[model samples]
Target: MPEPLGDDLVLLFAALASTTQAEITAALADAGYGDLRPSDGYLVQHLQHGPVSIGDLAGKLGITAQGVSKTVIEMERKGYVSRTPAPEDQRTRLVDLTEKGWAAIYATRRARAHVNRELRAALGSGASAFLDQVRHLAENSGALAALSERRLRP
Candidate 1:
């Protein structure tokens, strides 16, 4: 069998991913976000792009419609989102971000910047640059393209 990557490398990558997310979440909380989680951020970011049906959000998030509904309900309770009947389809409701959601998203963006600074300090310029380049490469790879296709397909 081909040699596997070193355990240290695998652990490093895992730690990096976890730390990045934790730092961003902490940053969002610091900026006045309540009931914040990575999933919540995903919902806000997608809704920020445009209104979406619960089914679409569930598909994008790789979650069940029931799970998405639960998350949406929590967000609604926290005033981060609101549901409005879709004009095109009265049977469907579109989830839209409220002012609170916008604020939460903005705070999360700022927090991510702070986390990026920490990453720069920890990884140094060279490793950081390499990570960025590799991320772009992976994002453009066939695997990612296939995943994206799956997401867009009905």
Candidate 2:
């Protein structure tokens, strides 16, 4: 017999996130915007706020600037994003969502809502409690700051 999986919070969260991502991907694929990946989704979410420099995006996403640049290059090629000289600093490029990028963002939002409804239905009365726990974890865990610090270290 196979060993039972250990109760690890990181693993639990990763598994849940992966499942949710797969659902979102499938829904987007069905909607004709399947070219987007999970990384692209993150980029789109960040761009939704406003244009940001690649370095800032890298910091926000806890990734290397090179990695963000690579993803941005691909997105730019696909017309999902546009890079322009930063008004305050010509040397820095600010990335913004193109029209297609906005469409992708809207599609992702709709798909996410659908998945949330499905999860709520499946989880029943416990769904709200689970969401509250997740919200608390995200807001107070300092995990993002830790990740950013770790990524910034040599």
- Could you give me the TM-score of model 2 versus the true structure? 0.76
Consecutive 10-residue window with the lowest summed lDDT within model 1? 145-154
Q: Write the residue-wise lDDT of candidate 2 on 1-154 in tens digits.
A: 6445566778878898899999999999998888888767666767877899999988878789999999999999989999999999999999999999999888889999999899899999899898888777865887656544433221
Runs in model 2 deviating more than 4 A are 1-3, 6-10, 133-140, 143-154
lDDT of 1 by residue, 1-154 (tens): 7446565655767788798888787777768874777857666656867789999888887889998899899989999999998999998889999998888877877888878777678777587688777677658766467554444222
- Model 1: how far is 134 from its true place, Å? 2.8
Model 2, poorest ten-residue lDDT window?
A: 145-154
True-vs-predicted CA distance for residue 45, candidate 1, Å: 2.8
Using alpha carbons, what is the TM-score of model 1? 0.77
